[model samples]
Target: MLVDFSAPVAASPAEAEAAAVSAEQVGYDGFGAAETKHDVFTTLALVARATERITLQSGIAVAFARNPMTVAVLANDLQLISEGRFRLGLGSQVKPHIERRFAMPWSRPAARMEEFVAAIRAIWHAWATGERLLFRGEFYKHTLMTEFFDPGPNPHGNPPVELAAVGERMTAVAGRVADGLLVHPLTSVAYLTERILPTVREARGGGLDDFTLGLSAMV
Candidate 1:
């Protein structure tokens, strides 16, 4: 079953690792860590190194904050360390949050996210095959990769890339492109049965195995 090891809040890296270890010991299938004021990627890396059996996941790392290539590199490393138990959950926060708070560019979030996923997969393919990155998209363009920057080959395959989406457009995109879609806590059961599920099914042609539906609730 899916599980969230911790909420999206600020915490020391050590604490996050400890939490992941404890969750693994408790027999959780997957442990998710969220993003907030703290550094989610660093925490995820630490957790991957600390836990042995548990699958480590970033509930929703803000996509606009970093380039997709960097995320791919880090995710590949984390997957290697965790024995291929890394889930890269991506989310594009509000435009205002990206531009005003994170000081990052925000335009056409859905389109940017589409390009971002493509770029990440391209980078992973390049690293896996030892080929030069020549990805060109409307938003992202990768030209070269030197020895110093190239991560070489990944021991494990590329990590699973999930997307957290709430709106209809984002949900449709997630179903079409993302490995999985994380359902937010605010969504009700009715919404899932009627709205979200139908939209995702339409996008994915009703193939249940090709998509994963994640939900959060009070236990």
Candidate 2:
């Protein structure tokens, strides 16, 4: 990773959608948006509708800011909107931002994130297979999914969940639960190749052929 001191401007939802349209026209493979100001899902939904071929992802939506059910529904909708090109990227933001800014609880982030992902998949399973939604865990509990609430198995199926992590514990959780790992920009190549990859591989108990890895390069 390299240090970048320049200030970058974030694109508005309309601007991001236009960029996606242009990127798709120019044959870009994927587009991702952060969740700093506007909701990432809102921006991605717009991009999903405006493009046809390019993949879309929520670069790192604050999982601590919202519950698993809401995140699940948002990801599912984005997948539907993108026609199977939506990848759900989630992050457990720091404690201050979670408590002071978002007014959400923050504790044992790694364990919480693992449970969050599990709860989402449980909900998705109930919808996809018409089974009872029974997910109970330490950080979250989701045992109800009425017929009206269930979107009923998304046509594109649920999107792949990617967890954003820089710490050892969270990175291991990503390997155990997430379909991909979103590496932090500050992570060096050595750290990624050594610490991150090893932790993930050990937790996964196999190769990395199917798992996706996304790294943000500073320009």
Largest TM-score belongs to which candidate?
A: 2
> With candidate 2 superimposed using the best TM-score fit, by how many Å does residue 65's alpha carbon deviate from the native?
0.2
Residue pairs in candidate 2 whose N, alpha carbon or C atoms collide under 3 angstroms: none
Tens digits of per-residue lDDT for model 1, 89-114 = 99998988899998999888888898
Models 1 onward score TM values of 0.93, 0.94
Which stretches of candidate 2 lie above 4 Å from their native place? 1-9
The residue-by-residue lDDT of candidate 2 on 1-219, one tens digit each, is: 211111123778887778778777766678888888788899988888888887888888999999999998899888888899998989998999999999999999999999999999998999999999999999898988888898898888889999999999999999999999999989898999999999999989967867989887675
RMSD (CA, angstroms), candidate 2: 3.4
